[model samples]
Target: MEKNNRVIHHPILGDLKFRSLINFKFNEKVYSGFEGETIAAALLASGVRTLRCQEETGTPRGIYCNIGHCYECRVQVDGVLGVRACLTPIKEGMAVRSGEKLPAPFKKEGDA
Candidate 1:
């Protein structure tokens, strides 16, 4: 069995195909996703619903509008913060972290 089977196949539009799979990390856990797909789409396809939590209320949040309108899917990508998963495209070796607050900056090799 292959991944990305969750992509809907339209009768008129034909089969929806994704690009080559790329490796990404979420909270240090590795996951595979296709190129050009939004981070939220990849996460949902992988069964990850909880994208992050409210900063003040600490309530769980996930993909709501799936567009840039909703900020529910905010996640930390690489060392940056407040990146919208629904609008951000997945890239190879991207590190994504979801939490109530922004994650600490990632340290590179030989960093003090």
Candidate 2:
């Protein structure tokens, strides 16, 4: 079998392995994943392509940039929307859903 160029093998990082398996919900479906891995990475490993929707068009989007700059990989984690999945670490029992907008911050009348 041939290897894909986009695939990566870390020599020093070597055979990435994790023992602890945790359960989390993604888009209302229960998924088992390991701790210490980014939510995006875990989802990608699990064949989850689309993460959230675009703001304007409401079209589905996924991890265009694995790094945290693009914001395409946003997901709702534990009721918080627009949380960057690429930056967030996967936790056990996390309720993750996909959407576009972030939960609006509460603003006091006199504060602003």
Candidate 3:
């Protein structure tokens, strides 16, 4: 089964049916989304609203402000830490992960 997370028509951008569909992995699960869209946008479209949980209280958090101001949409990409999901454009085969539960952050895997 194929799931489409993109809008079929846009008033400004015209038809979105021809946009490039790319596959990306989020916390080990593969999802298809349009290339060049923000990671937060793609995730939201795929019904994933919780980007990460609060480190202190474990409260769920997703995109807020939808810009670069607030840090609520932070996510790890390609082993890099704290990349803003709303500002960063997702690419094909990209590996994205939520912040608090990630091993690289908790274990400091590369630190000696």
Give lDDT per model, in order: 0.83, 0.77, 0.83
Ranking by lDDT: 1, 3, 2
**Tens-digit per-residue lDDT, 21-110, candidate 2:** 777889888776677778887788778888877665677899988899988788889987778999998999899998754443465578
User: After superposing candidate 2, which stretches have Cα over 4 Å from the reference?
Assistant: 1-14, 100-112
Q: What's model 2's TM-score?
A: 0.74
TM-score of each: 0.81, 0.74, 0.79
lDDT (0-100) at residue 83 of candidate 2?
88
Judged by TM-score, which candidate is best?
1
Deviation (Å) of 68 in candidate 1: 0.3
As for TM-score, the candidate ahead, 2 or 3, is 3
lDDT (10s digit) by residue, model 3, range 12-93: 9988655688889888898777867889988888888899887656788899999899888889999998899999988999
Candidate 3 overall lDDT versus native: 0.83
Q: Pick out the ten consecutive residues of candidate 2 with the lowest summed lDDT.
A: 1-10
Give lDDT for model 2: 0.77
